[model samples]
Target: AMAGLTTIRGLVPAIPHAPVAARMPSEITSREVLFVKSLDALQRRSQLSLRGSNLAAFAGRRTEDERSRLKRVRNKEDRKQAFKDFRAVATVVSALFAGLAVYLKYSDSELLYDFDITDDAVSIIAGLLFAISFQYSSPLQLLLVFFGKFETERPADWVAARIAGVDDPKAMTEYNAPAYAQVLSTALIGALGLVTASSLSKLGDTWSLSTAVGTAFLSFLYEVGRPKRLSSEEVVAREEQWSDFRQFAEARLVKAGSCHESEIFDAFVAAFPQYRDDTEGKAAFKQLRRFVYQWNPTAERTPYGFYKNVALSSTFEKGKTSALDS
Candidate 1:
């Protein structure tokens, strides 16, 4: 059926070549059987039919591109899962290996003698365990201190804004510690663990220290290569300042009975000179929007994207005048 272009006659020579069905009745003549010549022709027919469907292009059913894209996404997800699985397995295996080495050092096991497990090998394994401790310390901080300021917490306003469909905000809280400080802490704690374990296993200091330093260097190299995205204390300070600005803007908007973004920014800058130097006025604009969207009860957004002061705009004034006249 998928063979290259060929006529019915060529496909089946036993059929009559008279371009009519020989098995048809004498009164009615049989029409020549029409068939697709090849797989490409069949594909063209299927595509044509699909294209003729309602909104086929918009519905995205005609193209293989979407399917190909989905397959690529699935492949990437599979690769990611594989890496995670491998990491988990490596972690478990390393822990078990370190435990066995430590046990062999303490116990006069015949298996240690049989396997020729030397003191240097046990020291290296212990060092590797220390390196693993350092590798895991940053995340371990999360486990130890639940409220450690790591910039991973969602701000109240950010979450509210997302729920209101205003914006998709990133977690941008201030970190209490710098990257180097955190890294130093990890090293200190890992070293402490190594020293503590040395008491139990009585590891050879020379071999253990060398392996520990080498493994620690390599592990920390990966950490150093990662891009630092430190959220500053200034972010929290600025957000606090924005809260004050929101109050100021809301008061001004309510007092004026109506205003646009520029008017609000001008008034805000007059009150708080710190925002005056902001050339883009992005912060001021965000505050004003917050006031209009969430803060003010009587504030109504105008068609032109400004607010109409329900109490002070021209429409309100005219209505007041008409009521007085009546």
Candidate 2:
């Protein structure tokens, strides 16, 4: 582990990744140093266990204890990977925000427009740069990758793992907890960046700091907290979903003037068993409730609040009656 840390310190600058290089600092207080040192010691002692015939034996003949331990390790690794992807998405967003801040900071303070460079030329150049950015490794590319129609890389077989009975043979695939941790972790990383940037600039008054912090928190949720089932769809499709099921629930509640929270949850689960039973079902459930609550803020937040909340929400009541009346 220590050796790997040392290698990273020496080799990171050589790599062409500016973001990572920018983050690297004095390593004396880094926990990664200790982690690397431990890893190095273990590797030197029994590297063969990870290679050759020993590897096959390790893979095939895991004891019950080893299997359990490995399951936890696998879950942690999966969460780590998911964090990385979400963070990258947020990074693009944050970078764009920083660029915007730079422009805003300089727009009126300096005369960027002179006789040498007219505002028209500046506008043209900006448009050209924006157009060029879409084709390169920029937020525009990521936006397309996120929202544009693409070939489904996830094959049907990946979801076909028989993970019904935990008491039975351990499924080759593993499930993870909800994205609560991922959201929190991503939010913290963003907060840290905001703080560091503010401290360095020495210009983070309450309003500016608040804006930076809010941007970070919001970008993290936009990128990470949304469930896969609820994401990667057209805005129209997503809006349709919101209106469709929200109305469905509202209709059911109007008859009773309210329903139990469990009733609503069961209704959704019944309609989308595949989604509700999948690994991310809990996350999807949370997303559904959050969406419902947000669209109709009068919705209750108690165990029995759904029906009453929905019934009381004037926004929901108006929409529900108008739709049904139509």
Candidate 3:
């Protein structure tokens, strides 16, 4: 009976040992499962961080693009406002000058007043105001006011050529001394007529009328005989060439096919705002516009030949000398 009890006790201890060994594998498996879950969580966090970085980069690019677009829009608006301001100032000054001219004309006692204190003062004031108005006006308008119709048509080419140091080919074509002498003689004759008319007017006689008529006729003849230091023919030719060039330029602008003519015109005006008062500059612009019209023949009315002749007299002088030498 004692031997049987010892064997039973040994069996009990063996049973407990077998259970402990089996439980060790289950605990190890549980720890491995937890580690795997932690790794998965860490991987998910890394992916999220990468996605956030990409999103931020995209937003930064979008912001830069918006800023660039805004800058362009602001610049365009500023240019437009500047042009409007210039025009407004010019219009106001022009009106004032027109009023002054009317006042002077009606207030004068004589049919033609000499440039006395009153006359000189009015002229000075009017000229100053006119000059101011022309400051921001288009070059074409200013040229017309200063040089009349004689210098407008080809002023650009003449100026360009002069700037480019081209010698006037027509200067020597006419007799220089004779041309100037004729102009001086004509001017002197006109002055004499003016004097005589004034005297006759003071005397309350009809002599003023006869003297004026005679002076007019004499002046006309003198102008006809006067040799141009710059040949009129050359001036005309240059003007025509400039006109052609202008047409070509205009055609290119039109071909650009922009919907905004005003925008284009404004850009042109902006580029040459000083052209409004620069006689030659304005003429160049007018010629360009006219050329465009001629090319298309469907454009609006253009300036008359008034601003076409303000060329460098040196050109004509050279031509005259050449002719004399020849």
Highest-TM-score candidate? 1
Model 2 lDDT-worst window of ten: 153-162
Candidate 2 C-alpha error for residue 226, in Å:
14
| Model 3: lDDT to the true structure | 0.42
- Backbone clashes in each candidate structure, one number apiece? 1, 6, 27
- Which residue runs does candidate 2 get wrong by more than 4 Å? 1-244, 255-258, 303-307, 311-326
lDDT (tens digit, per residue) of candidate 1 on 1-326: 32333444355534544555556654443222333234346766766776765454554453456557856876676567446633643454355456656776677867664432335555546545553544433334334345643333222223333444444344433322334443343344444444533543554446555555554554444334433332444357457666866676545444334445565566667777766433224545665666556555566666665565423234344554222223
Model 1: per-residue Cα lDDT at residue 277: 36
Candidate 1 has an lDDT of: 0.48
What does the lDDT come to for candidate 2?
0.43
lDDT of 3 by residue, 1-326 (tens): 33544555445444435566567787765565555555556666667887987875786587668658866875676567446534543454445445545665667566434523234443334333323322222235334544543322222223323444447624332222243333333333223333333445554344444444443343334333433333444467556556545543443343211122233334445554544333334455555555445544543331332112111123334443222223
* Segments of candidate 3 deviating more than 4 angstroms: 1-48, 108-326
Candidate 3 weakest lDDT stretch, 10 residues: 304-313
Ranking by TM-score: 1, 2, 3
For 221-301, candidate 2 gives per-residue lDDT tens digits of 344433332122334444655665676655544432344455566666666554443333554555666666665667555
